[model samples]
Target: MVRPWIGLVVLSLGVVAAEPPKPVRVPLKAPHESTIPEGPVGEAIRLGQKVFTNTPLHAPKYSGNALSCSSCHLDAGKAPHAAPMVGLWASFPTYLPRAGRVGTMEDRINGCFLRSMNGKPLPTGSEEMRCLLAYVWWLSKDVPVGAEVVGRGNPPLQAPAPADPERGKAVYARACAACHGEDGLGSADVPPLWGPRSFNLGAGMARTSKAAAFVKANMSGLGGSDPLSAQDAYDVSAYFTHQPRPDFPDKVKDWPKGGKPADSRY
Candidate 1:
């Protein structure tokens, strides 16, 4: 049996363990909008912003789903935990273990096109691609090369359950149905969870773990506040990700050299 003082010391240790040390962010500055000079370059930058926000409207031919780039990136990729695109201009040409090779920044965007947007890859060197790249470049104009942004992607959290679809269905009814609809089809104010218009199986959201991480960060207010517990997030994510949605033809090509995670639908 432990003494009361020993128990208190253990509790104090647990509390200290809970708080993760903050990561040191690279010192870099993002260009201001007012800095955009009036000229063809400015016009292109503005167009790029539109492309990020109104993807389907601008690049209808390439879009296969209803989501715009802003859907996941959030606020045209400016929001922190939603994976801001601000410092990515200099971070690319890096190796992605998923691809098993060093790929250009355009490759990353095209990966989203194929998976998240459930769309065809934009033609190389197309006007649409140029505009999208320009917008990202402008966002990183003031950022120095080889620097990192503090909040570039969905923040991590405690490990969630392996996911039980049935439990998730009930959780969704209580917590998510209000915003995402009983059928999992989101309304005009929100993005759909699963449907013909939703992201394909190749999207990161399709993975149970990835969806759980995203839910941990933003389950309310369009990725603003999370009201559900970690287990609930995993359950709901598993249920929705397993539901019928578009399928990616190139799923067979992914993780070609092995090392696929357990939750991969393919």
Candidate 2:
């Protein structure tokens, strides 16, 4: 009992369907170290890399904790999804909701010092600041202006249920304690996860969701391992973020114009 409509449907099936569009991600590219220009500019770039990889050693005056910039940025800020700095130059002079104003690259860098490092802001014209800017600019040469890179920051995650610190403690002991230590103080090579040396309450990582996203993506250590489930990530993040750490007095000034995330510790 074939109908005329059935013939039309059969004909339609012969044509192939178009493929769905893929997720967009800007390829991260940076100039090779061998190509760094010879002279003061090159010197600045080199110094900047040193500062970034070992902030406490290279820029001791501004370091208030044991953590280096590479502790968070990872692979000298070249690694994606771990807050990579590649393509970052183009996105700045952007709005910062926390500060309630447009912030330049310098402001952004200083903000990390104030919150993440629990240290003081670098003077805008200081040598350390200039060198860091030059390094970032060199890294951003390949990216187009006014473009947004997909992996610029940590990916967002939502837990299925409320985060449980007790469950997180178990997860941390099994997975994280090897490198970070049971005390959370970490050794000389590893950055502390909590206590006075960790990021202050004002840093973005203090938020449960932000930390979970980071842990889910990158917390398996340099060799890499199986990724954590969203619930486990959320739970572990909740446990560590609530641990005692430095305080940021200026936190009160944040979100002045309004629009603070619900996860903010303050």
* Residue 37 lDDT in candidate 1: 70
Tens digits of per-residue lDDT for model 2, 1-266: 99999999999988899997654556766568897789999999999999999999988899888877788898898888889888889888899999999999999999998888988899999999999999998888777786667677787778999999999999888788888899999999899989998899998889998899999878844334345788989998999999999999998899999988998998
In candidate 2, which residue pairs clash? none
Report the Cα lDDT for residue 27, model 2: 74
Give candidate 2 misplaced runs (Cα > 4 Å): 1-25, 221-226
TM-score of each predicted structure versus truth: 0.85, 0.88
Candidate 1 residues 1-266, lDDT tens each?
99999999999888844676554476434577898779988888889899899888898988888889998887788877777888889888988767778899889999999999999899878888998998999998877676668777887765544678899899788778888889877877678889998999999989988898787676743333347888888888889999999999988888866788888888
- Root-mean-square deviation of Cα positions for candidate 2 versus the true structure, in angstroms: 7.7
**How high is the lDDT of residue 215 in model 2?**
92
lDDT of 2: 0.87
Q: Mark the regions of model 1 whose C-alpha exceeds 4 Å error after superposition.
A: 1-24, 27-30, 220-226
Candidate topping lDDT: 2
